[model samples]
Target: MKNIVIVGGGFAGLWAGLTAARELDLHGGAARITLVTKDEYLTVRPRLYEVFSEGLRAPLRPVLEPLGIQLQLGTVQDIDRQQRSVHLSVAGGESLALPYDRLIFTAGSEQRPLEIPGAAKFALNIDTFAAAQTFDRHLQDVLRAPDRPGRLTFIIVGGGFTGIELATEMRTRIRAHSDAATARKARIILIERGNVIGRHLGANPRPAIEAALREAQVEIYFGASVAQIERDAVRLTDDKHIDASTVVVTTGLRANPLVAQLGANTDDHGRVIVDEMLRVNGAHDIFAAGDAACAKADEQHAALMSCQHAIPMGKYAGYNAAHDVLGTPLRPYSQPNYVTCLDLGESGALFTVGWERKPEKSGAVGKQLKQTINTQWIYPPSGSRESILAAADLDGVWPPAV
Candidate 1:
């Protein structure tokens, strides 16, 4: 029997493992599929900004075990491509090596923390389940402490997707922990180094985003950069100070550093460049997906580091890996359609379509759609192999047929 090893347990890793098992099962091939990761739970990363609770994580065993995919909890220390083995640092500082006939690299991305003065010490982020939970506890601490100036103010560093969602929802989160008057007194401020908001999202949805920000009463500091983060405020590069009790940084994300260990050419974000079949450009018997691989979605756009792209990339990469081991044909990966559904808290949400991001829905309708996606669509099917495999199909419709 051949060994198929997958790294990471997030959306990409989970789906990749499932898809690989499904492919092998369809062909009646006996292959041992194992998914290795640092944690036992699949963190719903997109919802980390919304609220921190146990609901944000789903145990992998309930999903992976029924599919015959062994779950190994550990940190992948290095990949020895020459030896066809992955070195891992498991619990109690023990080391183990797993030789693989085929390797799927799904090691996901991480928050790109800024290297400014006091940032490492004073700034907080909701980049992961643990981090979000820490921030949630900090919010409670804020409520317990005696009243002070700027006690409820939150400074969001960036105007991108995560920053925008967190800023707009800050007040609502506060209200959940305190009174309406306290929530009303809270200040949500967004600081962007760029001149305009949602700079990367293009101009098509700017109007809706701006209106949502205005409705949320989020103050925008356009073209302003934070020089340093203090215990209770952030100092701008221009020597100006914005006092806020809490500072949340949403700078952006970088691909897992393990991509470099494969000795493949990578993009600026440290994502390995892969071929059409999602194989690492210069490596053998190894494939990459999710944030680890910079795969092209189409001729015009490359796959973004989001759930929208990661899920499909996982399916394709998994299928191609199985096919390679089975000496069968591999399918080329391509996703032409793109969409963006941004949650905007009390002002509702914004849903757009295509690479240009043309507005398709907004306000209540968009919020409902966003809620469904965050609460239902993104989670993996559990406790049933049939249902899980069905969801792992290669030609599955994305964004659903609504």
Candidate 2:
């Protein structure tokens, strides 16, 4: 039987697997739909900062099992476009090469390594589930110990969305493990090279974001960045130094390096460039989505490396890939609406609509909405198969209007 394979178990891969399965079922086709990923569970990446919370993941089997989509455990080590096959390294130190009639690549991104001195040794990250848990464990270990001079200072490198959220959420976490006096004296500093926080979010939301950070007792060290992170001190670009026991880096995220193995058209960050149909720019039988894909959202816009873009892009890519076998025309991919909801901890949250990021909601109301989006909206559609299929439909509830 002809196989339609999707790699990665992120937002994109999960959506692609479901939509593709739905398409096959609709067409009453015999084509097999298989999802090969490093793990069977989908990591709730957007909530990694909320690692302190109980929910951080949902199993792919619950969703994918409803459909006939087969789950293969492995990482795609390579893709040979010419051979139309992929080299996979599954669990148990085993290896296998599988051929495919259609392929969807959604490997996703990783935190960029800081090139600055001493960064690799001292800086912790909250990018992945593993990383976030490790950071939490270390924090618990530190705060549980008797008062140490620098152990209470938490230095967060980068003032972007992730950095800000982590910093704010961390305040409560640090306080939980320390006494009232130590918690009051605990230092939470955010270092950024730019003059403002949430620079990518445009100028409109900065005021609210800044105010929120300030209210959280989070200090912003703008206009400069961390030159180096030592065991107990962070050196600044301006030759200044701050004593900090814990350092968290959230500065950069580049597309997954695995996409480079395809040798297709990729941007500077190593994300595969896809055509309007979300197909790989220079390769046949290949499609990509999520952070691994650099797809044009509109005439003048390109999809960012976010779940907002990934979910819709995955739907389109999977629909198109399925149509290739169904002998139907493929629809062009587009997502004109873009929104951002940044979590601000105790100060509530900020919600913005459109690319300009004009604030639609702020404070407690925004926090509630953000919680809903994070907890319920983005999760895999559960309940009936009909409900999940309806949600995955290209023209239905998904690719929601902004």
Candidate 3:
């Protein structure tokens, strides 16, 4: 049996494994599939903001085991593509080497660090669970500090989803820290380099998102960029500065460094360039998905890096990879539909459809839809052997509501 190895257990990696296993079963288990991840649990990253407020998290083991996927808990230190091998550091610091007949690289993206001085040393990011938890602890510490001007100030760099969500959620989180007197009076400042916040979101929903931010009492600074980050403040390119006890950087993210090691065609963001089939050009046995890949969506090439794209891309990559190995017909990936659901905290949420960002819902009703997508749709299904296998069909449509 051919062995297929997948790296990174985020949305892409996990979905890849499940899809491949299902395909292999159709051929009487002619191929063995293994999934590698730093943690055994699958993080509901879309709902991380809710985790801060509602402490919502779901387990992935129940979903993987039933799909007949062997889970290897470890970190992929390096990939030897030529040898079809992966170098891993398993739990307890033990090292292991594994080989594969086919490989899928789904390692996700990380926050783009600011080059500004003191930014990395003091500023926090919400890209990872650990970072979010650390920021939560920092908020508690700030609340414990004596009531002061800077103590109550929180600055968020970026007016995108991450920045907006963090600012809105922090407002509520800070208020619930302790008694009313000790609870810090929240002051959140969002800085964006664009002319207006959520510019990429277009007109339909941008105004609603902006209005929600303002209603939430979050200040906005447009046409602004972070010039420097200090121990107690953030300076903008326009010579203006905001004094705050905490600073969160969420400007943007880039593809994982592993894509560079592949030495294949890549975009400016360092994502491996793949065709509609999700295969790296000139590499037959290697495929890329998720943030590590730049693939086509509809007629447009190189879709944006988001879970909405990653999940479907993963399913396509896995099924196509297995099809190539088994000499079966392949499936072409095409997701013409696009949507964006931005969480706006107590002010509510915004839901948009299509590349134009058409408004589908807003306010409390929109927030409920966002919650449903985060807590339910994004999570893996219970790993029932038959059901899990059924979900692996390459053409299996997902996010049924989407």
Which of the numbered candidates is closest to the native, going by highest lDDT?
Answer: 1
lDDT tens digits by residue: candidate 1, 1-402: 899999999988988998999999999878999999999999999998885679988888988888899999999999998889999999999999999999999999999988999989988999889889989998989977898877888888999999889988888889888878888888889999999999999999889889888988999998888899878878997788887789888999999988888898999899999999999997869999998889999998899999999988998989999988889999999999889999998888899998999999888999999999998888887647898888888877765854
> Which number leads on TM-score?
1
TM-score of each: 0.98, 0.96, 0.94
Error of 1 at 91 (Å): 1.0
Error of 1 at 310 (Å): 0.2
Q: Score residue 93 of candidate 2 by CA lDDT.
A: 87
How well does candidate 1 match the true structure in TM-score terms? 0.98
When sorted by TM-score, best at the front, the candidate numbers are 1, 2, 3
Better of 2 and 3 by TM-score: 2
lDDT rank order: 1, 2, 3
Q: How accurate is candidate 2 locally (lDDT)?
A: 0.86
* lDDT at position 198, candidate 3: 69
Model 3: clashing residue pairs?
none
Candidate 2 regions off by >4 Å?
51-54, 176-181, 399-402
Candidate 2 clash pair list? none
For residues 132-215, write the lDDT of model 3, one tens digit per residue: 778878888987877665787888888877887876776667767766544334777888898877666667877788777877
Q: Per-residue CA lDDT of candidate 2, range 358-397, in tens?
A: 8998889999988988988789889888877777888875
lDDT of 2 at 262: 78
Model 2 lDDT, residue 343, Cα: 92
Candidate 1: residue pairs that collide? none
